[model samples]
Target: MQPTDVSVSGIGTYHFVYKHDPQTGESGFSHLITPLGTYRTFSLFTSLGVERLTLVPWALEAGSQNAAVFTFDWETRVPPSGFFQGYPLARFTWPSGRRVNRLWAKRLVVYDNIQINWDKEDLLDSTSVELHDSVNEFNIEEKRQFGAGTLVTHVRGDLTLAGTKRPKPKRSGLLTYTYEYEYDLSFLVSGIRSCLYEPSTASPLWCHRAHIAFNSWSGYSISPLGANHFQDGLSSSLVLSQTGVQLNRRFDNSGRLLTFALQDSKRQEAIINVTFVYSVDSLLPSDMNLETIEDVPLRTHYRRGPGGRIEGIEYETVGSSRRRHVQVSYNEESRISDLRHYISDSQFAKAGSSESKHITTKFLYERGLLSGFGSWKYTFDEDGCLIERKLRDSGSIEDLFEYDAKGLLRWAERRVIPSTTSEGQQKTKLEEPFCNGLENACYPQEMGQVKDYAIQYLYDAEDRLVVLRNTLEIDDSIQFFYAHPQHRNRLTSFFHHGKGKAYFLTYEQQTGHLFTIEEVDLSAAADSNPERKVYIIITDTEGSPIALYSDDKVN
Candidate 1:
């Protein structure tokens, strides 16, 4: 037997396969399984024919086995004249167990009149499914000349389920389902054509009405759901028209209303309003853009404070788009002092009531560098470093600095008066020291209150730093070690914190460039996990060269 011919109401399983020519360089294939005592059906809708194959296994009674197969070639007829639509269809059933149905459609066509089959199972319910019409019955020509026409569809049933014990139900059940789709069409006209005809000059002379809807499960519900209206552009800026929402109440609830308001000016009057509603929450931001707020104009102003610091600032947008203004003020210590806002145009009259305060500042410079200023005086060493600082207010506060023979700041001690009346009483607040300048003068070598951390620098004959050693503050505490090239230009720096480990790094000699880094011998450690090894590679400007390659898995 042919693969397409499968016995109905039998105890066996059936398998079907289908193949077709590629469309847009892609093809689809599906496999279906039918259980025993049931029949299956397949359907498709397309302008092209389909090749199908089916396999059925015969019923086995008392150690008896048999196999059966069938194949079939099906094609849909082309359209006669105006609109043409097609889909693939199939169905199957076994004894009294289960039944399967399927249908496939490619492109949907629309014309003056068209009919669709709803029983076609290949039509999957999806958000992308839509029905469109070319010539709407509500157009001006149809209303003024031909009058309204009827659009309907007739659906057929599955033959296998027709006379069976439990026949398939009607296509449209009691509760109807409505689906509404909305779209806009616009065309631009030349200036010369627009000048001759006032409507033509308006660019988009038509604006579609909102709240049009459609229902598919109601057998056939037709009205202005597929309607189009023309508009004049001379004196009107916006046009509103609608369809289908009137026939189905559910359609009214599911449909959307759109408003097309137009404003055209010679300079900057063109505007478009987009309203999107989802459930009970809505978002609206007026005149917002990528950079600035177009709905409000902003004026800039600056306020001065002690030591030339900004104390207060205000932004005024009077006679602006929203008639709103804002002001902010700060105190002598650069703290926010006051803030005020006005929403009405008349409130701007109170802007003159803003208050201002005056502050005084004194300067104390050592070798042209600010050592200490304010209500006090300070002095520094010859190298332009703060050696002593004195605060001359109610109480006395002083800080003394000391340097090593190598001219590096070694230590500093601070002294403050115990109380306002006890001018002679002093107490030490803090004491810290520095060992050497390794990385740079700004980043010292020895740092911390306990002098537990120290760093040593090795320089070449030319005084160029070649290598650096970082040590812990405790005696004989060596955290880790690093080595650098003697040539300063070829030297590279790296940082690591660990114990009993060697880290390796590759660098370019000529450019002093770092190429790669690898941990030398920690792979066998108890904490090592194979998956923890990470590899990183660096590329050049053109992404061509492997400038660096680092891996944590090393031994």
Candidate 2:
């Protein structure tokens, strides 16, 4: 995937204003953006009592570009009635070019009806309402009111910088952004009506009473469960009782109690005495499934290096979906034969078991090339090339080849059924790289005549194959350089010449295992010093590496 464009309207569109020092040429800057109006609200209602409103703005857009225009609308519904009233709480424009970004929603407006009493203390009996735009589905509506009580609302605001600096391109780095918002709610009542009952005849009564506390600090609590792998943030307590309430009785005393109360006097009192407690607990682990791999056994021989020395050989029974037997053997040349052979019989099914046999094949070659198997029937041409390849119970192919005067392969072709497409045929092109490297000095007679070809060779200082002045192709080319130490038996590769130019890959001296990677970018400014960053990775037995430490020059 390509890196997103750094335009004003792209994914990472947050504008970063830079401040440059004239004397030292050092520069620094901060990111800022206006608030995008998205908020969450908790609403409570009783049949006859007041309805409480708790609004929280979802100010998580800490690093987003400022919207040209923003607005919030809240729609709330009172139970037992179908009609919903919407309130537009706040609207304002933010000043441009501020060093510190602001996510605050200004001029918040809350609509209140005096006839409907709000029960702030009881949230379980409360219902949540969401306000949505009729036109643009992406736009979210913000809540206007805040705080815990029906008669009063409080508003609070806080600010903090979004976390660490942006990462250099193509280098693995972490990006973090912090989000914060101040909350406050003020009390107000505009109008009231009776949607279910006649407004003139219906008597006003308080069904629930609630208490809402503000700015109260509650003690912290820890989770009893063990730590989970998937939890992202630190475990912390959630402040409670900042908003509290007591629900009161609704409707006339003569009416029978239903959803909110019991008939017995003691039962009614117990129901009224019920209280809610909000305590913080650690987030639980995400759900996951585990799958196990079954072990299979077989007899085979392993070869080590170019000379094809028999490193080791083993004979064992391998498990399979069906009953089977395996046999393996090696020739004096240390080449293994019959690597895998599967056999199945029908008579074993009547005996409540299946029967089959398996065999493994191994080979040794002079160089990196593989020789023929020992046990399987095989044939080779005068050039020591495999002529016939076959698999037991499946099919076989006979290769036909023609050679030139120098014994170089020419006009090579394989004849088989048109419908027979084998796995080996599909992978033949992939072996061209190794084959070309093995035949280093052999030049193709018809090189220019071939299409879709690549020149594969190692060019050393002595070669100096080609040189030109102001070469157009060389100027625009991207090059990757790798070097393997001859004496150390290890590889240390580096990347050069690219956008955000850098040096990467400082591998181990013995195993070629990567230990550390350092990246440097010089594309910022001609006069400015290049930025160098280093990341150290530590690996466990399973080859899973964890970042141990990191140091960077960017903010």
Candidate 3:
């Protein structure tokens, strides 16, 4: 048996293991239990393979075992391939005997003759009625194509082919648009392929041929995902002689990425190369090796237990004296209990160097929930919302969080308690905010604090923060406003009453916070151009702000 995927739920983490039958050459799983045997369940398979795993907790009465089982029902019959096809998940049955039926478009035409499985439903089921009902059936209009295989081009579906029901016009509702595909073919001179022969023994010298590749997507009107700036192909070396660069890619038998290399052909050296190694038995990533232009090799090795859970990781720089090792210890419930980090200059030290710095983090759990870590104690409400977090060593209440019935954070309080002196006098009070109780509190307000600070939040109907009131002496209240219906929940501008200033923000669809315009003294902005400052934000691929650029400075 080999471990496949690990599922982590609100209760516990469960590992799914698959047993292979040598005689039948088939993969299947019968039953699975959590590490501590707290939950038992099995896999749910449909024509589309395993959909989800059910959770079955032990019941006091033996006859109720089957009643505790959770299940999912899927339509096994394969639907037609064209147009808006494939029905959404049928229903979900919970352990408490509750069932939810879902219906919406779950597939879309992502490319010519290619449709991808994706959910198009919003939280409130605000999708257009025509779009929602068009997913279950197919039409002959969708099956018509211009060509076959790589040259195929699909016809756009007309509004007449849409569902019969028309949705009521709403200013805030989403507008569904149909897709159109246009293909344009163009060829580029990629590289020059040459054949060489030994000069001493060959009568003829060598011949070279120019390699040209053609690309078509309606004349670049519709490129693939990510704009198709880079080349993607099978496991092979793609040499772009025009740029003197070589892109080398390798894949395993199962089509998993194994290695990728980018080289400078003129220098005859690799600019960057990465290799991925996976465990033979479980097919899990075991190691990663990277080589840079500086020729410094960095390697990371993963150590796993019998159940394929990562127990430790070692990072090393080849030929360098620097090394770091991280060891993970799990409790009987298979939850990470401790994490120890050891850094040393000696690479081959088996027992690790005693002189090296060692840092360890310890975790404690109560009733399957993390209760404390290090010197910090945490308390949660019945809904699992963190209510209070206190530092045991310092005897200080770090944060007392309060949540409303909707599970939204309403307020948070931090208290600082001064220690007693030898003469029974109170120690110096820490520089912290002092907040008084407000209206509509979720968690009980904590008492006994030399100094305290609190912040209360107010949300709009759409759950967008509209106001923030803090106990701070300055900037006590900040009100946020959203004016752009297209951007939805994004903030358009915010006013700082104490500072008498306002900030207008613009966002890049993916990167976020493209520019911030700060206005000072809103009262004097009627005729005067209030002092304004603009700051540009830089972000990474994942839309996380990495740096702020302003006045020739990056922060």
Candidate 4:
């Protein structure tokens, strides 16, 4: 009997055909399936993830720290034409954490909102090289019909803190918002609407989402983690014409994003338009521009070295433009040995003109190991662990970091530089040099003592950070205590005391997760300034809180 077509669910299922949009998705890459166009695959859907299915994403991108990646096996062959096909399967890169190069290979992505395909197979075989080296490839010039698939997203705040500045204990304070959505054939708001998100809305906030491009498709947010992983600076917005909100997206033959623009009810020009540029062999964008219809376009250009590593980037934008030129260098061992950043105005090109007011930051490394950044230098103990770090950016050691023998951090101090005054920023003339290798001393009059401005941390035998002490000003002592106040091997209590205000948290745990967290405000003397106790209650097995209540109100 011939193997018939059957739908499968979950991971690693058998006896079903894994096919790309069997007959749909955009034309170019989506339609091309296996190398032979008859191969089967054991495929699974993924987000920005690593190659190993059993492993979880170790770290997440908060902004543009790392690029977006989907279907990680793209470095070799093309994915079988299954649910999401057309993306270059062989363009996948397992990047190093530092973004040695900000190239198109890092954040290549294809959304199902565009063309999609699936692969089909009869069974799972351990001997199939097609499963390991299979990469999703693309074709050109295909028209596509899209659908607004199911999308779920929730974004919350970072609720749990370590020593001080305890977050609100209400479950409401922990969630920015939870979103559930669906759309018809075209991706539009099927039920609920999308909204704006304020940073301070939650403490230990959490965001979660599973789909893309809903009408309310405001921001690319929400993950199981309280982490921000979208492309840097992705925002939450509505597309309102004089009639209502509108969302639009366009893609080219290889499924690379051409533009993501929003139109509104007012019929004003598109509020936001993001365009991408790429090399033919790569699925990621080598250059990108994100801007409003009326604003000067902010652009990002990636530079690559002979090995395809990102050597530098030219970023033109506001706020972050000052630190635009990021250059990276490697050691003979091929590890990142140095990083340099030149801060200048957006108009300053990479010309070798002698008239550039570039604020240069140079990184320092010991051999191939990172030692410090810019004017910061360091000393290490015998064990190769970092010991002391001194920042001499302004001729004086503006900051110092010290660690214990076990590599635990012990002390950190930062000197506050006074602004230029009538004395012109406390100018000092030194006629005599310091003995041997001693550094010059320049302390502001505001600093009463040489060793006063610092913070200290203490850890337990188990290597858990347990205590923090602050001495920001002369004779002002602020301390916080952390202990396993409820369950063993768990620290649920954090008492913060400084200034005249204090915050205390009592974490409630069930099944090793936060169940309810209560917070109280206190006086400097620990007199316990009585504030209403805020409560966070979890109602699900995943420890997702459904309600956050405090003082007879649900927030």
Candidate 5:
């Protein structure tokens, strides 16, 4: 049914059909007609359960490149008709209709939101492979509890591929971590419809209950821990047995987190702790306390002015008489106008330190856009893209930039010249001979004195950077390679014309987990052995490189 009145509340619903014509008694409303013919029909007296079935278009020729996939699996085989089967839309069943509580008498447990096929097999796979090697692989196991409904309540994982051969106490300098969760069932808002009287059902919500870690770097294992929960169903405290580390949390009556502390149980001292103090009349934090395993604990107090704008901040450290203060002034639009930082000189402060060591920074805005700050002035286009930045005193361009239609940097240039008063000194400094080991610095500065340098970026049709050349080295540039089928979204190799070197990258997986780079020298002597270097990248759990190891001296 369609409504005659229009409402712009919420997301502003719109009627897509054209207006009806009363003269012709015709309504301009039609169902979306697709090339695929009707595949299923429902009887006039079909059960409402059929509404739970969902069918999606599945084109046999669909692929990443949008080209026809010639090869087909047995499950996705095409028909012999030349016209070709329009699509192979897979049917999926929604779990809402088969929820457990609705059919409690049947004594059956149903996993909420888990898609299943006709065979009652789960479509959502919960397995993940983190790390794999020839000897071992690291996998994480998720455990779900099935009482009223299914909910993940435990997580068990280990990092042991590189630790098997090491001593039990020193397991390849890695940490094995585990997590456990606790949940509580409560009734919460489910649907949003004012006219409908849908009842809210109680569901289980999980919360972190315990975190365990075995740090091989410290040659110690943290034993399993059990924690108690607060009235709000939050973990209140956790204690690690083997390792003398304890975590504690405190909340206010309103369930607002007040403090969280990580303590060394053996010494009965907090290693790191943070506390939030709220104002008596407002919900905002009035002050905060941060205590690390350092010499002193730092306290920051916030002072708010009219409109609840923070006007000042005061910092004080325990066992120290001196304090640091920051004064903030805001414009009419509530934007920070200026900030002044200085050391407070109270009677208990150090004798020599005073407000004389203060630093002030002012911000200038034009039409709601930042125009200048400190000794630099910036010019931006209508779209708020910074196009130029120059020194306010000398009016000399310090940096210039041009962006493409999509706001990606297309050209950039930098001009570095000392101020008029210091040009002579800078020239002398540039011409001065450096010590035996430092010649590249003076050589580069000498070349920069001749003219400004600019760089041009060239991208392919996919908007992937392909070439980069600079004005200083017009004939030499860097070329990137992504031609191979395996290098669709990953960089395969890059050649540096200026350095006469080509570097190839290798990953642990096909398109992820970069692990190594092999550098080859192109300018090496023909008869002599060419110079080559291989660098190994060590990555962490998120597939981010944490360290680089290479054997340059040996090579």
Candidate 6:
């Protein structure tokens, strides 16, 4: 079964141990006896007396069924009490008792104590289970006070997905079983976070230890509960002698963040705080006030729609009479189409407001897409592709777009026309061409343009892009190479033109990921601090892209 976002269910197995009751001369359970099964209806046992395995509410709109089939050993075991009238398994099959090997999962339990496991475990030659949960229904382990045979059974098995077809721990001479499993959250609370109960009465209880969740694989240490868990080695809860920068926070009744105060951080200093306010129906911030951080007061207000979507934001500063505000409006397609700017400084009369005091700028869109910025509007082709854009105030400039049949951008052109007041419309046009179809845009371009030299694109019969270059200048082109030719996007190494500097694009042997160890020339390296040339990116194990440096900073 495919895992859905809502619910998870699993089937399980139970081994009922029984001993001979000397007084009754009958085999009865010494501890954790199975509930008596009565003949409820057609071929059905009434109550198998199981724990968990109940579907109520989200589990199953119907409460609890409290019934199941029995598994017993005809060779040595008693039949469930009062089941001769109910469903029939096999005539004379269990005249003595029932014999079943597998059962359904009785309950799901919250398991936060489970450690991360990427390593495969042998399913208990019988059964192995994967467990990691913040909150989940769990099986109730029934125990009798001082019951017989205190020996706890150690069920050894491989941890595997249920219903997996590999020989069960018993198939291969192993008896493999199959059961589909999917777990989902049941209840999410929004108030003073408290506990929630499982749908079934037999649901067991588990608690969260509240440990600071930090990864040990990375250079991070796990702190004890209640201890400060810090990122970048800065602590807000550490108490040192008479001084500590302990940050504290408070939440409203709706569990929404209300205030962030530095009062507790340094007790001797004046409290520096920021408070958030909201309407009764809004869980989102409506207003925010900052105090004690600067000499003057600073504040911001949020205007929201009936649906709770933020519509505008206004900012106010203590010393400045002028305030800034931004208002947003959505188009028919529910995408942001316009953003308006305004200043509240009483620079004009209330009649209509002065031009400078009113909308300073307005951004517009077409068909739910950004079409223009400030008095400009965009027009699209029949295929809903942007074809042209021009300013509403004046057609001083225009941008043109073209696309291939595959919906890939082929080229774009920008033309700046000289205003009538200037040098009579010289119309300077610049165009950019994009390679199509290939994942890496490997083919380069067709080499046909208003002004160009020769650009050669070489590839095998497989259509893989191998080489590209502009005969005009050696430093103005790019080249590609591959380790796995079939994977077009997987360029093992390539050469890039970094504004005159030739960069060798290669993979880090340790991570098999691409990096540009910009082979800078002496002219480029002449700049400051050579140490900054070495950039460190830590996406070694996980394939996550990182933008460590902002803008054109160092390497």
Q: Which candidate is the best by TM-score?
A: 3
lDDT of 6 at 415: 57
Kindly report which residue stretches of model 1 are placed more than 4 angstroms away from their true locations once superposed: 1-361, 366-371, 382-384, 394-398, 404-406, 412-555
Local distance difference test, per candidate?
0.28, 0.27, 0.49, 0.38, 0.45, 0.36
Candidate 5 displacement at residue 89 in angstroms:
29
lDDT of 1 by residue, 1-555 (tens): 326334333223356545455664423333344432222234333334443444333222223443223323233432222222332323333322122333334333222232122222222212122322222211100000111221111111111111112222211111111111222131111010000001112221111111322223222211222222222222112111221111000111333222222222221432322222223321211121111113333343344433334333344453543232234454322334344433333333466522222222434332234544444566754333467756556434566665422234434555544454432332222122321221111112121232222344322212233223332321221111112212224322221222222233333222333433333332233333322211222322122233222221111
Residue 429, model 6, lDDT: 20
Which is the winner by TM-score between candidate 2 and candidate 5?
A: 5
lDDT score, candidate 6, position 227: 25
Query: How accurate locally is residue 113 in candidate 4, as Cα lDDT from 0 to 100?
Result: 15
Sorted on TM-score, highest at the top, how do the candidates line up?
3, 5, 4, 6, 2, 1
Per-residue C-alpha lDDT of model 4 across residues 19-53, encoded as one tens digit per residue: 44646441111111221122222334444532211
Q: Residue by residue across 1-555, what tens digits does model 3's lDDT show?
A: 366556553235566656667896645775566666544546545456225545454442334444355666554343433432553345566554445444334533221121223233332122222221133221211121333332322222122212222233211111111222333343221322222211122321122222223444211111111111133453654443334455466777776557766655455766666777887775666887877665578898999875778899888888877667778888866778997766556434665442255566688875456788766788865444688888777675578998643456878888766555432333322332321222111111233454577877655434567557665533456656554323457665666645656665544322243433334444342324556555544332233544453443435
Q: For residues 158-239, write the lDDT of model 6, one tens digit per residue.
A: 1111121223221111111111111113221111111111123132111111112333332222122122322232212221
Q: TM-score for each prediction?
A: 0.20, 0.22, 0.42, 0.34, 0.36, 0.33
lDDT of 3: 0.49
Looking at candidate 5, what is the lDDT of residue 95? 16
Candidate 2 shows a clash count of: 47
Give the runs in model 2 whose Cα sits over 4 Å from its true position. 1-328, 341-455, 461-489, 494-503, 509-555
Candidate maximizing lDDT = 3
Ranking by lDDT: 3, 5, 4, 6, 1, 2
- lDDT-better candidate, 4 vs 5: 5
What C-alpha lDDT, on a 0 to 100 scale, does residue 53 get in candidate 3? 47
